[model samples]
Target: MSYNMYLSALLMAATCCSLAISYLCWKRRELPIAISYGLGMLTGAFYTFGYAFEIVSTSLEHIRFWLRIEYMGIPFGTVLWFIMVLQYTGRQALVRKWLVATLMIVPTITFVSHHTNEWHHLFYKSMTLNYSEGFPLVTLVKGPLYKLHVYYSYSFFVVGMVLMIQMFIKEKLRMKKQVALMIIGSWGPYGFTLVYLSGVIYMPIDISPFGFIISGVFYMWGIYQFNMLRLAPLALQKVFASMQDAVIVFDLDNSLTSFNQSANRVIAGINNKWIGQPAVQVFSQYPVLLEKIKQGPFMEGKVQLAGHADEQFYNVHVSFINDKNQRPVGKMLLLSDVTDMVRSEITLLENARQLRELNTFKDKMFSVVAHDIRDPLAVLVNLMELMEEEMQTYGEDQQEIVNEMGQQIHNTFTLVESLLEWFRSQSGGMIFKPVERDLAQTIQINIRLLLVRIENKQIHIISEIPKDTFVYADKEMLDLIVRNLLSNAIKFTNFGGTIRLRADRSDHKVVVSVSDTGDGITSDQASMLLQEDYPVSSTGTAGEKGVGLGLTLCREFVHLNGGEIWFDSTPAQGSTFYFSIPTLSEASSKQSDSLRGGRA
Candidate 1:
């Protein structure tokens, strides 16, 4: 191949590269910047393609023909690049139709003047073939119109460079590398154009096409490394400015670097003039918020700011912004207005306090009435028992009537006692004081207390509790739990039915069970049995009535003493209620023994 053929091959290589870059940018043509950039690259492809053929052309006519083709891309390339710069630097709004048409005026004039230069001699004074450097080169004398085009191109280059430099300086730290690569890519063409104008090197071909190849390579690198086109400054700024929350950025040295418009409402007197100022000074009015920001890389808390009418609340989050290597570069403070949520929470607390006071008053009044009713019922029960004894000589009917009346009065008294206990527990009037006690003894005492009713039904009582069994629990609570379970078992058991009591030690707790061969509840009843809101009221197998308050009190006292209660039941079969409480450790048993001895 000759020297001219080699030069043509170089230009063709650049043409192919520019075409590829144009295709890449065109794929993302949805963005304004990408559209402009792709058009610029397409023009670059045309410029290089024309130069490739022009470089090898031997005839002056063919050279002039290819020069006209070169003008097809050359005049408009710089204007497209300037438009791309405007979009890339968050200035897309300035790229209006009128501004674009105004910028195109000079390039369009240059293209028209160049094509008509033969008639007017305005674009080029003269054109001739020069056989210098062993190759044919088309050389044109300087014309007034050509000089105007050069100055216009150079002006666009300077303005684009200035805009890109300003963006590089003001962009976030995370985006600096991306902007730097873009600026480097743009400089390739500008630098080569300057060298070509300065006559720094003698060559038969213009070297600006090769400069585009450099730009294409750098731009491709930026696209892959930094996602340059995908994350433009225009979109970034719009999202940042449109956020409802206040966002403030600080450097590693705790100096204010950037903030959004919403931040103005949060930080008093904050503005662009505060950039580079120490964060402590900038946030001096909000010492609590500042202290939280300086404490750690990540934190979240509530803060109150003075408002026009009432205080405003904000949920502030501080997090460190990290670099590619996971190193902390700076801190970002995000303040979200939570004034409504805070106010709602305060209102809820006040309502809850008032509700609790009303509930306490209601419980006390109910207890007072229950207590007053129980005394009269108890006195009547005692009087009926005395009357039954005194009227034993009267008749069997009279004695039976007295016994029936006494039983009715006794049931009422028992119900009143259960009501008082329930109210006391609900109102927190009952204190929980756990102590070591023998489990077997306590269970035996409750069984004996309910023995009269148990025998009336002829239900067999079985005790499987070991004599040495002991637990750590409130003495009154334990007695109540045992009494209620035994009473319920007795109440539900049929004639000659079996009621068994068992206590077994497991882990740190003792499992106690009260099972009765009585009417078993259904699955739905068992599920809702323990729920406080769904109280179970039913008649016993012996036609006895109850409100199920005993079981509820048992569950409450069990949980208060750090224990649990559950039941297993089958329809038409028997049911077993189980509860677990802490067993007395060796240390606790010894302490109880010593205390009893000291009291003695």
Candidate 2:
């Protein structure tokens, strides 16, 4: 009715708009609790708006309208205030619904009582004036329902306040204190209303409307200045930490301001010591860390450290925290420790190595098969040519010639059978049955198997294999690896050159070094031999053909047995292929442990 109430009405509109914007922001973030707080604020505005719009003619009607308007906020403010409690305290209210229902019932009865004699005086008295610019005061009277309204109204306030207090006590104080303060501070509106209602401070205009305006303003302060409801800061901190991210917050002058426990542990670091020290001093143990941070953010690469720790990678995201004046306050170093990622990278590299070695092994097998097949085919062709010559020379004894030719054809068939068997195994079409056997015995078996080829090449075989060594590996896979190695050794070595089998147990594993005096590989070629990919096979010295599956199989088998396989060679000097397998004693009964050791 008056200018002051009109002014309060305008303030309510402004409050509503501002809070709506905040609510929108909160909705965008999917924060239902913050949105509820915003709704609480808007409801307070509606309470004020109701007072400003109604020109009450009497005190009873005035009180009734005011209480109804305030009661409308009961569900919104009461529920939302508890929602805030649930957000901060993670505790739900036990009596929230009852409090809301009681609050709403008061106004509903008061609204309905306007038609009855008992209700008549509750809202208004006798018609004191037909019309007036100002509302009249009522000859106040109270009934049971009026008392109920008063009871519920005060009960609503008490319940809301108590819940807010509980939330304050339950939340992390450092981060949530400002929000608690905002809740406490919002009591100013109700306090002023109480003062006005009790006739403690009488003014021409109702001050309760202004009270809502003030409350709304305080809420805005909480939202804008304090970030009271933004859990994202704390949430992000937790998420990053859980993700194994190392965070370091720096102050204005480039000092280490704050860092999580992980950050301290990640560097050759200490707890608490890094808080006030210069960033350079703290990261001095890991000098490259500063360079990574200085690169702005988001560098995914390896960082070499001084200690024996493995090389790690970091994906850094740097942020500059600014002061209230919008000046740069400090830099935030958010480093996601990608040691696992680095390990993955290393695994990929090893896989490439294994794949290349696999290709080389297949090539070796292909060569061996082609050679064995070619030798037989060549002999068979020559035998046929000789038989043709013999058929003409000794036409009378053709039966003897036919018998010798049949034996030659049978030898060729045997060679073809061996080639086919090896091919099937190389193609993953065959599974090996590994039996635990002495390493010395396996070496002896291979030596005997390659005895004919070794003798034909005129190579001197030197056996320095240990007598008691043992490994649990696929017997067939081991045979193939050793046989191919010896065959390649003999094929490439000069006549009368030495081929040595040096087997020893070292590094908790059986180390087998097969060295050869041959036209060996260069360092560069050797690096790529088991390291990179080239689909085509390189020709062997004896012009053999096939995949180098033997070396690949050896590497794979060594891996399966919890060991390693590699090669060290020099051009034209010699070549040595080294493979190691853990002793059978090392293989555990735990299947998962074995999986990790063998397959991880």
Candidate 3:
């Protein structure tokens, strides 16, 4: 074989192998395959053209055939450019018909006139004769149209190369390793062109042949890596479906872009519709949740599903995604079913409330038991005095002292009974059962409890609580509420001041007010007057010191039984304590003698 024949054999073998590889990869739908195919066509055509030039140096005279071999790659290789990019990147709209036609036809028409005219070259116009030690050697074979063909060919090549480069750059962040493989597949044909033009020949067919070969290998490698790296969309979907919490990702429009299993269920069950729907529409259904779409994509609030049998309460933490200006775009909502937590909280609050009430009960119990015992003790002391006087003559001063002491003891008993009753009402161990009674009659009875002090102060009692009006309240509690109010009013009144009682029905509810003309309570003291267990003790006008709590117990009993008590007063003008309850049935009008708990 001659030198040219030897080179032709190697070139033919390389081209054949590349063609075979190209054929095998033709069906590959991935973007890289398209790139490899383009490289293969360019390389195979370049090598076949080189072989034609070397083996058929005698055939240049048949310009049509020579031109056919010279520019065959121009059309075939150009087709691979966009086709590979579309396949590799999966973008089908890369090249249009007019573009492919212009690239192919212009090169074909120019290269076809290769042999006839020096100035009319497509690839080569004339082959310059040269000598290589008398062996036939060709120097620069310049074609008149060669520059046009070169300019046009390179133009298509550059445009395709630039496009593939752009695609590589765009996906680099996600597939950096794979993109590197694609870069080789895309630019390999150009590498082959570089070796051919330099004439610094290296091996049988230049690197173009091997460039295509390597591209095919890389395509295989990239496919494997795509699967191994878990970038497959199918795998991604499976992972999302398995999540426990509802994970919904939204876009700038506040529309639901995607959601996980839990999120889908929540939206379907609560929102009634969530896919592509605005997040605010579903979230606002709960009363506790104040939908603040005006503020952000997400808001944290309670979900009180009005009629859901589950009665599940959730603490939803809604998140908002906004633009740079803080304008809402989309939202992600995470609902945590905190129903158990809420119930637990309510239970805790109830226990705490009950405990506070119990402490008030303890205060009232001390008031009444002390009185229940002291009342009889004072009577016994009086009987003892009567017995002593019956047995012997008593002195005038001693008798007056005995009578004054007895009176003082009676006052203490009355205050104790009031406080004891206050205690019983605060403890839920005692229930509220209002007994009906004439408002005037109950007042007269309670007044007697304060009679000794009333007489001592020379205070005039003005009973304006109507005789016809009646109050339905726990007999003992009503007595205590009114008694404490009246007792406090009278205690604060000056020696000559009058205690006025007024009871009337206002809006189906009774309003009983006790007004005293004594030095009025300080504005602050009046406000503190109704505290049930926490007492504000002050010295009365007659220098009376309290066991501290009286009205506190009264108010609790009043509240427990669906009544209200309040006080209004001006400093030095006097303070009036008002207590009201639902009027009672006539059947419940009689007082019961049951020991009611209270505090003084």
Model 3 segments more than 4 A misplaced: 1-175, 178-244, 248-258, 264-336, 346-350, 353-357, 360-549, 554-573, 577-600
Model 2 over residues 162-265: C-alpha lDDT tens digits?
A: 76676566545443555565665557566666776678775544465566556656665664566443322222334544545677766444555456667755
Candidate 1 lDDT over 245-319, as tens digits, reads 998877565766567889998888887556546778888878877787788666454566543234566777888
lDDT (C-alpha) at residue 87 in model 1: 71
Stretches of model 1 off by over 4 angstroms after superposition: 19-38, 58-69, 83-97, 112-121, 125-136, 141-143, 162-184, 220-362, 371-600
User: How big is the positional error of residue 283 in model 2, measured in Å on the Cα after superposition?
Assistant: 29
Question: Which lDDT values do the candidates have, in the order given?
Answer: 0.75, 0.59, 0.57
lDDT of 3 by residue, 76-99 (tens): 565555455444443433345676
Judge candidate 2 at residue 274 and give its lDDT: 42
- Point to the candidate with the largest lDDT: 1
lDDT order, best first, reads 1, 2, 3
| Candidate 3: residue 417 lDDT (0-100) | 58
TM-score of 1: 0.45
Off by over 4 Å in 2: 1-30, 55-89, 92-142, 166-177, 198-206, 230-409, 420-600
